[model samples]
Target: MTEGLLTAKAVMERLSQSGQRVVTAESCTGGLVSALLVHHAGASDCVEGAFVTYSNQLKHSALDVRDETLARFGAVSAETVTEMAEGALRAAARATVAVSVSGIAGPGGGSDEKPVGLVWFGLAVNGKKTKAVSQNFEGSRTEIRWQAALYALQLIAGYDE
Candidate 1:
């Protein structure tokens, strides 16, 4: 199996064993993370749902991302992803964990400050402190999105609770 599918399987097994369900909030990676998770058989047991909030307006309307947060920190910042993850968990009533991804996976639309392939990840678990991390990958847009989805799966698999 490919690495992304393998990671997704591992996340599924982990969540099943822990009796936890996961939800996803995606931006630059779109629904790739959710797609990977659902590729595994019986994903419904572990995957609560996914929100592909590609636009800032959807991020606010669907995931309840604050306009102030997006304006101040930008959509791909740690703050925005943190809120995304938390909002996903809150929106998905059955989800115990949420993973949020936002990035500049592109051949264009990149500034010197936030270059292409710069991805931010957020992990929110029930009763635990939410966390955010950023990675600067180097590759085509597809590759960057794939890497971000894989990393998001890894985050779900590695969650202690």
Candidate 2:
């Protein structure tokens, strides 16, 4: 099995044991995190759903990402992903946890401040403070996206309570 699948299985088992369900809001990874989670057996028991909010408009419409937040932070910032995660939790009634990913996984979309392969991840767990973190990966666009998806699963699997 791939690393993503392994992590997905672990997350599924953990959430199932805790009676928690997960929802994903994806930007750059394009639902890859959600797809990996559903690869596990009995995934529907732990996965609520996914939102492929690739565009900023979709992010706002589907996940309720704030326009002010987007204008201030852009699409790939910690603030945006945090709002996306929290909004995902609000959108999915059954989801106890939400993971949001936003990044520039590309060969062109690079800058000095927020270069390509820079991914921001947000995790919002019910009754816990929302968390955001960033990772700078070095690889092709596909590889960066894969790494981001794997890391999102890790975030879910490593959540404490």
Candidate 3:
């Protein structure tokens, strides 16, 4: 299996042991993060569910990402990503941890402010503790998405707060 998949499995194992569950809210990477999390055996034990909100409209409607957030900071901003994570946590009250992703993964749709491969990641844990990270990956669309998913999994594996 790929390193990314392996990392996801390891994360799932840890969360299961801790009696915690995880949920995913995804955007630019589509459902890649959720897919990787469930690719391993026994994932059902720790994975709650996934929300694939690929559009700004979907982000607003499905995840309750504030329209003002998207309008002011755009979909890939820290604000929008954090809202996505919060939305996931709210939607899955049983999940102790949640991760959200949004980005511009493309050979197009990039501007000076938000380039292709520019991604934002958000994590939300119980007590509503949260963090947001930004990454600029270098590659084709598929490579960018794969790397984004892998990075998110790695964060979960090392999370302490």
Off by over 4 Å in 1: none
lDDT of each residue in 10-103, candidate 1, tens digit only:
8899899889999999999889989988998989999999999999999999989999999999998999999999999999999999999999
Evaluate model 3: give its TM-score.
0.96
- Per-residue alpha-carbon lDDT of model 3 for 94-125, expressed as tens digits? 88888999998898999998999999999998
Candidate 3, pairs of clashing residues: none
Looking at candidate 1, the ten consecutive residues that score lowest on lDDT are 152-161
Model 3 stretches with alpha carbons more than 4 Å out: none
Best by lDDT: 2
Candidate 2 deviation (Cα RMSD) = 1.0
Candidate 2, after superposition: displacement of residue 68 in Å? 1.0
Q: State the lDDT of candidate 2 residue by residue for 80-136, as single tens digits.
A: 999999999999999999999999998998899999999999999999999999999
Looking at model 3, residue 115 earns an lDDT score of: 93
